[model samples]
Target: MEPLDSPAPRPLAHIPAIPIFDPLEFDRSLPSSQYTLIKTDDLRSMYREIGRVQAYLHNLINRGDDTPSLAIDDSKRAKTAAIERVPPEILSMIFEQAVPPQTDDENPRETHRLAEILLPGQICRLWREAAITTPSLWSSIYLKFSFPKNSVEKMVDIVTTCIARAKGYPLSICLWNQSDTELTQYRPIIAVLLAHSHQWDNVFIKCGGGPRKNPYEELQGAKGCLSMLRRLKVEYDEIEEGGSFDTFLISPKLRIVDLRNYGVQPWHEIGQFPLLPWRQLQQITFVGYIEDALELLRMSPILRVFKVSVVGHSVELYHVHHAFLLELSVESLVDGAASDLFGAFTLPALSSLSYAGEEFPRDAITSFVQRSNIEQSLHTFSLTLHERRDTLLIPSSNIIKCLESMPCLSQLSLHDLSKRYTDTGPFHSGDISSICERLEPRPILPKLKRFSITGPPQMSCVYLALMVKSRWRRAAGGLVWIESVEINHSRPCAHAKSSMTQIPAHIESRESGRALALLRLYRSEGLRVVGSLVDEDECIECIDEQGYGAFDPDEN
Candidate 1:
């Protein structure tokens, strides 16, 4: 096997950086505000004075001072540093922006978000006061267990402190319950959070399944208290993806939901399912069959984004006409039922459509394009092609036709996940070549700006890069010249189930090298170009690893 090159550095890191007012003054955990008796003096001058002292001492220590007692004239120091001159309110805003994301950050690799806020508090009394006064600063709570286990007491304190600091403000919380710790131990932490159920605005709880009964059930008490709830995301241990909430079902302002429940077992049954305020929902992500998707569509008339993972077959076409939906994405977890959904949906307001299943429902989609004028309306389209036998799951013509139909499409991602090229045997190009060739023609997808393609082996990379190099110059004929290209090429498996990030060099050809250099040049010109050539079989994994973007329809 050819050795893989060094995995490239992060090209343009996106910090899921969405934020709001996050002041730290109000905390619910303490019996009362601990700093009430403490004077609220602006200590920025003191902070600067202290910083100078620490730096002097640090350098003195490096110079081998055993006991260097230093005296400084207080009158020699400036009253306030220039940075300290910035208003505390504005400083609060800066502090919030500087707080690392709860996840997707690797620099300091924070596991508990408590550190992001707590570290700033330790910086200076003035910054601490600024952070404390800003309630929004403490609202986005990430309650995750650190590996090797921090004491249960410590975890509980962190959770309570964050929630308490949020005061009466709505909370945006993410909880991770994946550990070997006994269920009883984690309950205290979640109990602290549940006590503030009235503040739950956006909650994401991911449970690593084991026990059927869980702290998530504690969420049941949040029903009437969930007035502030807007979004709730729950990934249950499929073994017990239980629900039938008493009050959560009736949240007045709840607008978004995302779930990873597979079976229609008890929770998914028509009557057994929780009776949520489906009418007010604006977005929903569900993983089930076409019939289940139809159920959500029936309930959420005003829904804008609907992403579904099709589980089983539903060939009996049931039509649905929805005018308010904007983005619809479908993938098959059971590998055949996805295409069935395309035949059922007719979305006129749809701006983005993505599909990854056994078949590409070409005729049905083409008809929708004609009926809804989606060719003009759609902006982002993604397709994931898999290997069935020696052939790709979706035909080349179907992909070409879909691209041809979407003239105004701006963002495009095509994944050629065919694994037939393994073992140096027959190398079926898996229609990746055809898609590349079809996209090179001008005026096809005239508005296309961003393109992403993932393929199996050497030939796919060579042809894809060549096609990109040609389309790079297509500025005429009313075509929007390509702006970004994200490529993921797979390496031959030398070890069973082998997986590791690889550098750019999969093929040593001069043509491939030139294309690679051109892509780098494009990035140097302030365009987005990222390539991930890896040993893993999963195409989506590479995209996720790049952290440049999610190859799927849009981020969840």
Candidate 2:
């Protein structure tokens, strides 16, 4: 059915009635005479054309007003061009001074935080390009990404950009991946980057202390990745479930290899690896091992610094068939089975030696020291007993003998790294005090520069005093002293305190009374102290938690 229209159009809500420009009446009606039409087209075309001419003149007047403003802008730009300009070389020098890249320890974890700080300062486009182009600046690369689940894409982008900027120069790559689950996912990206491993000069990879994957396979697959490698360090903890022993050997061009805390393969296989290629090898550190020294000796010809820490039950003979003109740390358990290990281990060129497990037989330590001394190149020597209590027990008198043996030692460090422990075997008390007594007749380290003693306060005090006296006697130069004393007043058997009773007698000596006063004041306060003394009498201001002491106006 068709709908019927309304009789008249209903007034629309939006429309307003003109009412002939209504003044008083709200709805004024227009007169019929005003509605008459004027036929302008029939009248004249010239008048209409004249109206167009007036509109053109109005636009020209407005454009003329804008011309002066444009001229003023041109004048301002000319003024800006008059300033001085800096050359590219000078700019590069400024950027290099402003942004220095971070180089980390043998392990990559140490430098990770530092790299983040330096990364942001390189925000300027020109500065960033300069930094990235500088091979030396970009040499140390830190690649760590396992943050959010969606970070892999961003990680790949950053790595690709860094690689492009590296421009084929040898790099120090530190890849710290914390997720084993993500490892397989990211393996392809790593393989692509590491395939350019030959571009690495000194690579240090410290995987996160989380589950790890077989990174060695990726490293091996990288074509010529280690060709330019000079030093390599791989430190992974047990937390990285997939970490393996041979991970440290990924780079064949490694000159210095440090394997710490990570799981590794058998010692025989490690020893069997050809040492002939590492002709330039100087240092090898194996902190935790399942094998003996004799087995590792197979790679000793070029070895300079060898450190191995094995448990008491697994002590094995660590002998040196060749003389090395550097440092050596070969130790075994103090049990009877360790005699052969100690006797057979001789370091003719050894300058530094540290024993951690137990004191070897007096005769064996003495013989080892005597042989080491005759070499005449020994410069630094150290002997430490790992476990001690209140008693000053000195298990290896040979330690004292070893001090006397190295007449040429320039630097000495004596340490008792052990904290309070229960007596399990033939134990002695007051070991720290006895150690101090043995160290009293300080071995004349003619070139001694640095000396540190870490243990209880009583022992540390005697040790430091004796060290000072020794230096006084020899008039050594450029001495750097470190005293790390733990203030624990819980143990009543304070032999270090009882033994220092004689200090009053020394204090009474008129020659050193002033120095004794300072020492006494420090002791009474029970404040842990560390600093250096220039002259015995002059108390040079030093730094501590209390802040640095300043020059006094009255004390000229």
Candidate 3:
């Protein structure tokens, strides 16, 4: 045997390589000596020597005395190639998607969106250039600050940097100041934003809980500063006796305004407030007295949408008709106040009307529809009635009369106003079935395509199927078919399961299975049926706000 410390043997260069034996005759032709030689201690020692040499070579390579392993070199090359392959345009698109979504109210210091936007720029030179040149990345600015003596200076610098980076692009600015300092603390930041008002597309300002002075008093003489402004939203915590918004009167391009007064004192009278370009305004949302809303409506000749929540009961208007108004939403008004308010306006072009409150004035709506030319022009209507102990009954005759008036109606939504999941109210299946029966005598809404019903489980699948059948025409092939039907009901409790499940179970098992059978048949023919049993703790926030708990058909 060789010495343990001796050098390992070298390969025999003189020997030619050849197979020791034919594997086909292995068992029969193999000798015992060949197996013994392979298992011997000499061969084992050679294998160990080979392993030690390989480890020593690896150590040398890692110590930077030799070239790196192929794997490491390949990874670095691949990274460089990938970065070079992506064009600037595609990189900009990816950056845009990574940008955070806009929020209505957000603290500036806590905003992670700004950090996300600035992170890519700090990664490397290539990414930094891509982020800087993308105008959309810097267009949205949210400035929220509290008084700390130095906060004003910091905010000014930040605002200036964002505007400079935005580079002539349109801006969407949201400013919120919850500081309790005097109004002067906010002047520098406000002045910086107003200096660039010509580039403002959408601006929201809310500064509350400060000194008694008005926060917007700094804009007293900044007329025509908002030359390119399109939408403005302002909410004030307090308003002095003579405070006015006359600064915005000269904004020729202003089209949308949302104003909220959260002050304890009464707002100045409509005539005493700032002058607006009423005819040019397209949409306005005001939360103030009914008289002020009426006065604004009287001056708005081409207004298309108006949403108002009234505080008083009476309204006076001299204009007999509004020619261009198409949508009107009345909220938080009593029956008498709603009637008086609706009586003052003749909306000739009104196509959609929404009323939300405890008491829905059906007679007042019917009278108004008849008086105006809405019977022929109205197409979409919604009524959300709040739950009350008095059990407000929606008269079937009134519903039928209202449906008869709107010949061009395409969509109808009926919903209970209570957003709580456990609410059960006065809506019943009989009322809906009666209205469906009225539609059967003659075609009331020939163009009606979508029907939504949301409340207690009073509406059965049978009445809903009948309503769909009445609107369907077999002979016409596919000329007329109800597009969608949505039904939302309270879930049955464990204790009351016997009562809720027994009726449907018995009918489905023994009695005529007309309801379930018809619903299945219609669904096979392209009618979408969405039935949901809501739990007391079910998530209502996930539901769509526009439709009455209806699932989007496209999602299916």
Candidate 4:
């Protein structure tokens, strides 16, 4: 009368023979006499009975099934339920975040492309459907075309699939081709991208080819096709010369442009250069001659940020003014060229200026500061000298005079390459001590808050402490407090003595201890002192204007 799945009533006689061992009691070691006693035949019979019972129970539970069907069903239902709980809109947003953060013209790694975008679709049917339906997830297509012919076809197919799935969304595309011999094979991929130029929001392309082989020739027809394009970055083999970027001139919405030439060929003449929509651009970075950069700046009236590496002498520009330019960065390989370029610009709203080269033209910098009348407005100034010869060090007087001109300056960074490997001359502790002593009495840079020095480790901690103390001393009754001081040793001090030399080591150790103690005292009063040995590569270049004035010690 009972259901087949229900357990049968236990026999009263067998209850006494059943195991009654308590788990806790069994855990302790027991004498052999205390063990349960059973004959071999009895144990075999018990095992047979247990096996029969298990089979019966299994048959009852899985009445019409065998291969874990119920478990599989339950798993499917759980997964479906969880997925159904998340609406498609929210899932799409999640997929967007899973994709790597969009970078301006940064080449996406192959691993990132697979794990973030492609792997999600392969997870399950539901995930595949979600990913396929989300246009934004597939909008960024990064293609590399250095593969063999067969692999190139496969890559093209993959790119086609991505474009199809993008579903009319604005796309961010990056194409890279490093093969020196496969120009014919990669041209098709370039063609495919140009076909969809109307949907491009950001596009970056870097390729190698001969001087006559322009990989971007297809772009000429796509001139009017770029309706939504915002950013464009192009880099080609320097040998590929004399190509015009006139197609980009029609991109009305373009705001940022970066063009890099990685070959030995010089930049095309200004007349042959791309005719960009200069007035509409907000930021421009050009690594070309001074004449070309000046010409571009002259045309870019509303440009906010400008960075250029001048390969030749500064060209004189008479009565040119940039009313809205906020930051200017110049890298002049020739000595005094940077200063000449600085004097050429009359940026009224400039707040930050960065200059780096073989020479730090103190007199030219002074003249530019006086001529531009930025002494009142300039807040951040950085100078780096890469001169290998130590014939002329940047005079402390020149630096002091510059600081005097920029009364509102808040951040100052100085990197002397000559001092990085050797401890001598103006870079020595005595000179630094004098400089700090001079700063103590001067009212220059009253609002100065952050000071950074990158060079050898020979800077006298005593002078550094004095400089910090003088700047932040409350007894002086100034509103500004020196918030951060960083001393980055780019190289090991050649003059450092080993502890095996007892007297010299002891003296050095004593001086170091005193310096650390002084720094700690300042730290207790709300100042930050950062001292560390850094690799030469970590040294921030003054010519790198990307975030020149944006260094914050608190963020570290």
Candidate 4 local lDDT, 1-556, one digit each (tens)? 4333235653321433334233335466444443433343466677678766766665654563333333223445545457667776777788888655545432331212534678768877777788899887888887665568767666777778888998798888876666464567666666777788898888777776653445566567678889998888776444323446567778888888876643335444424555678889988877766666777788888988887777666455454678899888778866666766777768878899888887667677777777778888999998776756544544466667767888888888877635332223331453333355456666667888888776544445445555676677642645378889877643333212221122133343334334434455566567786755222222222212323222112211
Local lDDT at 521 for model 4: 55
Q: Ranking under lDDT, best-scoring first?
A: 4, 1, 3, 2
Per-model TM values vs. the true structure: 0.62, 0.56, 0.66, 0.66
lDDT of 1 by residue, 1-556 (tens): 2112213432222223223322334474334454633322334445556666666655654453354435455698768876667789997788767544433111221223666767767877787888888777788788655434457777778678777777886677887765553455566766787788878777777766555434456566566778777777776444333444445676887877876657535333543444578888888888755676787787788988887887767667578889899888878776456556666767888898888865566776777777776878999998875567645344465667767788888998987656432222122254465566556554578777898887655543444544555556436767766788887654542111232233343333323333344455445556576765323243333434544221113321
Over 241-287, each residue of candidate 2 has an lDDT whose tens digit, in order, gives: 23233433445666666655524544343333322234456666665
Candidate 2 worst ten-residue window by lDDT: 543-552
Ten residues in a row with the worst lDDT in model 3?
103-112
lDDT of 3 by residue, 1-556 (tens): 4332224552332233333332434466445686655655465666567666666655653463245333334445645557756888888888766544433221111222366668878977888888888877777787665557677888788778878888887777776666554657777877887788788767677777444444566666456777776677777555444646566777788788786653334344422544567778888887876666777777777888898776656544454588888888887655466766777778888999887777767777887898887887898887776776765565556666767778778888877633223212222234343455455446667777888776544444444545677675331332255687766655442112232334343332211123434444566677776655212221222222312222112221
lDDT, model 1, position 504: 44
Deviation (Å) of 96 in candidate 3: 4.5
Pairwise TM-score winner, candidates 1 and 4: 4
Whole-model lDDT values for every prediction: 0.62, 0.48, 0.62, 0.64
Q: Which stretches of candidate 4 lie over 4 Å from their true place?
A: 1-140, 163-170, 177-182, 208-211, 236-244, 261-270, 314-319, 387-391, 420-427, 430-437, 475-479, 490-509, 528-556
TM-score of 1: 0.62
Order the candidate numbers by TM-score, best to worst: 3, 4, 1, 2
Model 3 residue 145 distance off true place after TM-score fit, in angstroms? 3.6
